[model samples]
Target: MSFSKIFGGKKKEQAPSTGEAIQRLRQTEEMLNKKQDFLEKKITEELKTARNKGTKDKRAALNALKRKKRLEKQLQQIDGTLSTIEFQREALENANTNSEVLKTMGYAAKALKNAHQHLDVDDVHDLMDDISESMDVSNEISEAISTQPAFDTVDEDELLAELEELEQEELDEKLLDVGPSVSDRLPDVPSEAPAHREKAKKVDDDDDMAELAAWAS
Candidate 1:
């Protein structure tokens, strides 16, 4: 039997509804926000304890506080991300058609791109949202493309020329950073025999005789 006949004969499982998926996303967002809040509180308490301690322990406590503060900042970013995802889920929920969905997804994509531009924290949730949105848009685009006429001609020579130019430009940049070739930098090796040649030759002959005697024994 063909592979498609075996696998395609079975009915594929239905995916969850958009509302159901959005609810799940919202729950996850809430959970992350709560965790972030807890981390923030813990960091704050540590900072307070450090402030009350004596000078000797104060330095150590302060270092701990700094570490905790860094963690708190990360958690705060997590909270922000959760909020952003929740917003995206809400937007997706309200979207009716593929076009509407695309619009909402575009908003999420733009938000993520802006976050990257501004050096904001990028979490897994943001990445997943971007990917999910892009995949949905891509499927629609692919479907549309499939309905259109296929192109028969491609300018391979033009593409090859562009590729060659790009490669040459990269080689040029690399050559600019490299010094002159080894032949230009170093003197040529001498062809003359060394003054110790006879002594060295005698040492090799003696070692060869010792090896021959050992092999004979």
Candidate 2:
């Protein structure tokens, strides 16, 4: 049998895409909303008619109520239809989301595979080892460059002791220089302030400073 005959001479109809299905459902919902509004208006009008004709025209009032009942039934059916469409649309959206996520995951897997094609675990380890060894060699070279100069040949203990002695001498000179200023400041000392005792101590300090200076010179 020919292929066309095997399939009843008809091409299979393709199902709608998710997007198209959702859009169609939305359109149907809009149309149903309009239809619901129309039915509600008709029912309201029939109710008004029945109310206006109430005792004066029994047959007309009954007819109006019957029409209202039919319009209300149609409105209920449209509400049910709207609910069904909303449920279907939400389901389609979720399916589309899952499909896109799955597609992206597949693409990422392919990319990861391609990226690792030229890379080997052993080669990576070897590269890292070479880098670490080079860093160690560079650190050694830096240490050699920054080693202490010829100053290391000198005695640090002797130099430090001499430095301390020089600092002490400078401090003594400054103290002697300040004595004259101290006397000038206290020209009129109070009697009970032990001014004579302070003067004796200053004289001894001056004598000791003079002897030290003469020895150094």
User: Whose TM-score is greatest here?
Assistant: 2
Q: Across residues 96-122, which tens digit of lDDT does each residue of candidate 1 receive?
A: 356577989999999989878856356
Best-matching candidate per lDDT: 2
Q: Distance from true position, residue 163, model 1, in Å? A: 99
Could you tell me which residue pairs clash in candidate 1? none
In candidate 2, position 38 carries an lDDT of 92
Kindly list the per-residue Cα lDDT of model 2 for residues 43-71, writing each as its tens digit: 99999999999989999999999999999
* Global CA lDDT computed for model 2: 0.94
TM-score of each: 0.36, 0.66
